[model samples]
Target: MSLRAVSMGAAYHTAGRVPGPFYRLAPVVAWTVWNLNPAWRRRLTRTMLPLCEGDRARARRAARRALQHVLEYYLDLVTLPRRDMSRFERDHLEIFHNERLDLLRSNGPVLLVSAHTGNAEMAIQALTFRGRSFVALVERLEPRDWAEYMLRLRSSAGGTFLEANFAGVRSCIEALRRGGVVGVMGDRDIQHTGVCTSFFGRRVRLPRGPWELARRTGATVIPIFSSRKRGDQFRVYVEEPFVVEESEDAERDIRAAVERYVVLLERHLRRDPGQWAVLEDFWKVHACGEG
Candidate 1:
């Protein structure tokens, strides 16, 4: 069947034990899904429409590649448990502007703000290889077993996860206070706790957790992203990091962080819209304010 047709739970629980098939057949399944999944095509194409300057044809092509990238990420993700992480880091993952990660030691409890465009997990793995443990803030995926499996793979590299909950928030705060790295995705607002912001010149609500956490903890907020350069070769880009000033105007501070993040997000998405692996319609479906 198609790649998207299989649930993560079933995939991991069954064929995941033997990832040889997953490794070889992933591209074929991704291609099949991209060609046959009309709903998926429509969703990704619409998400890329505004970005492509009205070229629906180009948007379609980008949509296909975007889906392929997402599938490749899943293939690597589901099968990563069996690989040599050290070799994976050495051969597959590379970080750009790596010196910026030094902020973790200089003035730390670094908060990495990333989007869905790239495989942020690769970035996490790269950090883990460098001996920096992280407290990654993650949204719970569906099918409890699948989520647990993912969390396990995530923790395999000497890091921990902060689930999207009050307890998780507390843990994240504690970790930051202890001068640890905490990663958060600043793109989707699954919690509905986000402040309205602009993205791709359209109004959307990105997660407030990253910026608010930084404001509260005074953590260094670094905008990072990752992309598969070829196949499994991932390049993690570390953008300029900043701190959200805890001023008397708290709302302004958070909003400013949101605005700055979106500007960079838009810039990266523009570079190669196909790297945006989000399958949902980002503008209307996920937006808080009308565009």
Candidate 2:
């Protein structure tokens, strides 16, 4: 195994074996290191300022909180395998608009679209615990071994994991066609060939795969949001499902669907800007060329 993978594996094993309270210190250390790193601090500040409307102080505070939440999220991941389901449900997981989920459950297939906010991995696990079958579309990590490790974790959550590739795309379609749920992160476009849409009054490219899949399979697209409420606690919000409009022009339909997702994403971001953990220069990336 690669050195990074080996190290990660050891860390995960250690974290799992250790008691939960011992792992709580991890977020403090990680948050301190995050603040000490100039590059990371700059990235966080740059990403947060626009979201905070140019308030430097508010941006800095939000950035610090975001990093702390990220560390807590990672700590939860390591300890997740050993967590007791009853305790997990009672202490950590909170669901809102659950009736909406029930409504979708009775329908055909569902496309659960969410972003990189809160403990998203945990959110998926919570859904699986509720007896929802999911095929999660994931981006491969840098080291192959690390990707495999994450794949194992995701699979352990009682969901099928598919990398974001052509083969994965085929599997997603098959899963949806079989009346299964397919979860996708729709905020960022790793595949550069995404459809351009307006977000926070700025043009951004969001992954069009979810929209395309919904259109092709006639699946209902539901935007889900997960946000941290407190230490190791999260609230998951399930929005009403909507069908992507079908038209003669495929491209236009995809664009419309992507824009709709962006609108939902913006609404959630407005509610908790700090929870939107985007560390890149999102606003400036494709501002000039697309849309």
Candidate 3:
């Protein structure tokens, strides 16, 4: 058995057994320990420097908050399977501009590009509470059992979960072909293969799956995001939705759509960098080359 599997399983069970106050304070402790790690501090500071507008102290503060929120995200994710969907949605989740979600129910195929920011799972669960069912393309965690645990928990709310892979790509295309709603994480290039584009004024690679699926199926691509206001309070942002024009130049259309998605993501990050839950050094390659 992998160490990650043991740790994840233990955490899930322990988190469920702990008292509410200690469960709530777990993030503070987690982030405090995270900040004590020199490598983690560097990663957080590097990420926050630009997002915090170059204020070192402010960036550090934001970075700390961001780390805390990240731990909260994992905690919520693990314990979600035990939550009462209706009570959770009523007491914790708040959707801003929710009317925008109507696109998911329309006759046409819908593609939502999301980020690691905030509790995206919370947004997904809330949508399920409203009787909305969609396919969420999630990264497959290592140690197969861990991935299975994630899929089971996420799909417990009636939403579909597909691993981001070649087979998953086929499934996504099929879903869109049936005019289904599909969501993909737009910020991270998990597969390493991506479309190079400008984000935060620096060149970065973003996943090509969403744009490709949209182009092939003529699906409407919407740039949506979620942010943790505090505790269980979350905001799901639905911005401009557009279709990729199938012009003579396929690559151009995809790249242009990517640029638009990048703009929306940058706008969200600027509002509060701490909402971004990805703790890894995201920009492993930046400003390397033009698309």
Candidate 4:
């Protein structure tokens, strides 16, 4: 059997046996990925030292432990078990799905801005299962097989997948024009053309895509994040639309929107630090000066 199939089968089996297998699956996956993914391993060493302080060598060791926690969470998400939630997940899903369904029913393009918070992948299922044209801008997949597997998993939403690039931006706009919802992560930096802003009392760059898309397409920018509740349950928080003013100076407008987004994101992260899994050097504000 294929690796993806094996993983899927194991996930289902675990789900049937336990209340939540994601918690268990996450650590194992992270450890495996850490061992296999040399790129991430190097990044972990470089990015983590600032967050942990001790002897330089010891700091790198400590950082690995911290990265493990965050990586494990990522693993849990990639291998999330069947959403056939027990009593706990069911009740919360009802409230969240119902409200989102209502919003989707309305005749307007929506920009669903999400973050890397608790079980966010599940949010796609909750929003799209009932029939809504939703597309997400996904980062380029590495390790061809894993990429293919992610594409299939994401296809559960029944939405088109677009690469995170200019072409993808065009496709997203077109999708929005057709009255579809386009979901994008606004909290993390895209590293290209991102506007620097303050987050968690430090300067960090955020993707300009969502804000620009909203301004160009006139789509309602709605903040949506699904957080794990007590057991299998999750709370999908959907805030009201943010009204962004357009300006002749496009840069100014985008920056203004980014600043507002930073505020909203900061509030959420502070309220639930665990839910916000930003383990990288997110606050490395200034560009390193020339030697």
Clash totals in order: 0, 0, 0, 0
Tens-place lDDT digits, model 4, residues 1-291: 467556644644554345355555655666777688777666655554443432457545544544455644444434443344233235445354345446677878888888876655566555665557678887775665666666665654355666687888899999888888898988776646688666544455678889889888888788877665534456777766775668789899899988887777666654544465555555553322222
- List the candidates' TM-scores in order: 0.89, 0.91, 0.91, 0.72
Off by over 4 Å in 3: 17-19, 285-287
Superposition error at 64 for model 1 (Å): 0.9
Better of 1 and 2 by TM-score: 2
Model 2: lDDT of residue 74: 61
lDDT of 4 at 16: 36
lDDT of 3 by residue, 1-291 (tens): 777667767877888555365457967696767757988888887778878778888877777888888777777766777777767666876766777877766788888888988887667666655555678888878779878877887787667888998888888888889888788888888887788887776677897778888999999987778898766677888787789889999889888888888888889999998888778776664333775
Cα shift from native, residue 185, model 1 (Å): 0.4
| Candidate 2 structure quality by residue, lDDT tens digits, 1-291 | 898678657767886668466446756775777867988787787778767888888887787777777766666666666776435655787888877777444647888889988877677766666656788898878788888887776666567887999999999999889888888999888877788776666676788888999999999888888998876789988887899988899999999888877878878876788897676767665453554
Which has the better TM-score: candidate 2, or candidate 4?
A: 2
User: Of 2 and 4, which scores higher on lDDT?
Assistant: 2
The collision pairs in model 1 are none
Worst 10 residues of 1 by lDDT: 1-10
Residue-level lDDT tens digits of model 1 in 138-202:
88776666667677766765678757888988899998898888888888897888888767767
Model 2, global lDDT: 0.78
> Lowest-scoring 10 consecutive residues by lDDT in candidate 3?
282-291
